[model samples]
Target: RHPGWPARLGPLLVPVGRVALRPPRLLDGGAWSHVRTRDRAHLERWEPTSTVDWADRNTVLAWPGQWGALRGMARRGQALPFVITVDDELAGQVTIGNIVRGALRSAWIGYWVAGDRVRGGVASVAVALATDHAFNVAGLHRLEATVRPENAPSLRVLQKLGFREEGLFRRYLDVDGAWRDHLCFAITTEDAPEGLVARLIGSGRAQRP
Candidate 1:
């Protein structure tokens, strides 16, 4: 977790057309449960459940002490978190978490597209929106993602979004009980094509709401 990250990150409302990227809400309990189990296998490798795994919906259940600690850190500009949803259904989660400002106007982008939704290219379009939201809405300038070298699906998502392969970082994130090597990828505001959303969806991948 890097420090001083909030100043560099911002907010994004789901763009008008791609309705799947709507903001998740606390009352979405039934749907959230559905996605948790649906995406369980996909997420476990990237991020383990912490005491705060359900923090987005149940803030009160968070360890009061830990909540206060994180709130203080947030108040002081340390990090930001967001939940991702698809067409009013909980399909995944995306976070521009671990922000680092100043010279590093960057944040680590992490996401998962539900197993049932894979191959539909839901993530490809959603990610472009997320990155644009981070830059256009959040006012951040750079976004990066890391994936296990074996994760071809995720890598494809990055490629589809025009993220350049940067390099590999060995033993990066702990997955399913072991640390794994990851290939890094990124897309900057400058590298993105204008009207990328239309292009991605128009390719006949994203099903409009």
Candidate 2:
């Protein structure tokens, strides 16, 4: 385990208005699987290709193992995997991964929202909360995110949170099936002296519920 790990293994709650983030739970498998299955077409375009059939019962049965793996990583301080909630209901996920301490003190941020929940600022608020935790609570210096060039909504989420465009990476990640070009966006602790969530709220891009 990393020496800098949070004092407690988390269900760490970061809430603002109706949006909240919490660690993923073992029992959430069914709901999580359902959302992914239902949003297959909606999400696959931006997601890495997966061979598993999300709608299959076997896939749902595998949730515990997946959750366990993430939990282990969290325990080791390698990642922060959080499920986004709205009005206490599952809405999406915001994950802080690839943490590198010491000289770098950086991590990667990634997220997705349920199809029906899109355009409501759920992604923005969830990400802001996660970024705040990564910087303030988890003691990271910088956070980075990548988006496919065509993912306008996701690009907007990063932009609204004040992440600066770093550059573009060709064939950066495999999406759906083919390798796709991606734009890199990053934010450092110095970028938001007041906190990312506060910056987001002040910009009028996110509102209190």
Candidate 3:
């Protein structure tokens, strides 16, 4: 049987310059919605086709429940859903999902930055933090991320964090309404010392928050 979910999760904080990562909150709905609404086109170009009806008011109202489910997942140690904040403003989100413990000890990572934050190193910082949390705090042996071959920005993020290219998966995921090929990238605990965050900061790719 799976572990029972807890009522709450302990605070998980990661700071980088004016950027910080924390669990999602209900109060973030408006800001989250705004970012998504504004960046829908920008995001869809590289993201999977989301079934969630972004234009529906009902869907907007369901933010709390959606966030609640993420918290539940975190409590059960199955996932970590975090929001990236820059100077107290919501910039993006990163999630480590499909966590498998036992022998595999791995998970898949995904993320998106608000259109305004793109190319500004927000995704890089967020990825670094997520990678650190996955290998250090979560105690996972490995973390993987898949990106479309044309997604230069995301590919750069993975490369900066030392995720090696594993191979291409043909029709790996349904993205932007089509089954698309993806380039797999992965990093294991043995890949870096002091975690990816320290490496990023030390390399001057990101500033310490």
How many collisions per candidate? 2, 0, 3
Mind sharing the TM-score for model 3? 0.87
lDDT for 86 (candidate 2): 70
Query: How high is each candidate's TM-score?
Result: 0.71, 0.89, 0.87
State each model's C-alpha RMSD to the native: 5.9, 3.4, 3.8
> In candidate 2, which residue pairs clash?
none
| Candidate order by decreasing TM-score | 2, 3, 1
- After superposition, candidate 3 runs with Cα above 4 Å error: 1-17, 51-53, 57-59
Local distance difference test values of all predictions, in order: 0.61, 0.80, 0.77
Pairs with steric clashes in candidate 1 = 10-138, 20-87
State model 3's lDDT.
0.77
Write down the worst ten-residue block by lDDT for model 3. Answer: 4-13
**Candidate numbers, best lDDT first, in rank order:** 2, 3, 1
lDDT of 3 by residue, 96-149 (tens): 888899999999999988787677677777778777767766778998999999
**Which of the numbered candidates is closest to the native, going by highest lDDT?**
2
Which run of 10 residues does model 2 get worst, by summed lDDT?
7-16
- Write the number of the candidate with greater lDDT, choosing between 2 and 3: 2
lDDT of 1 by residue, 1-209 (tens): 33323332112223322334543444555555566555656666566434434435333333344445544554655444434554445566565666677877788788776676666655666676667666765566788898888888888888877789999999887665677888989877788657456556566655444
Give per-residue CA lDDT, model 2, range 39-151, as digits (tens): 87888788776786546633578789878988899898999888887767777888888888999999899999988778877888888888887887788999999999899
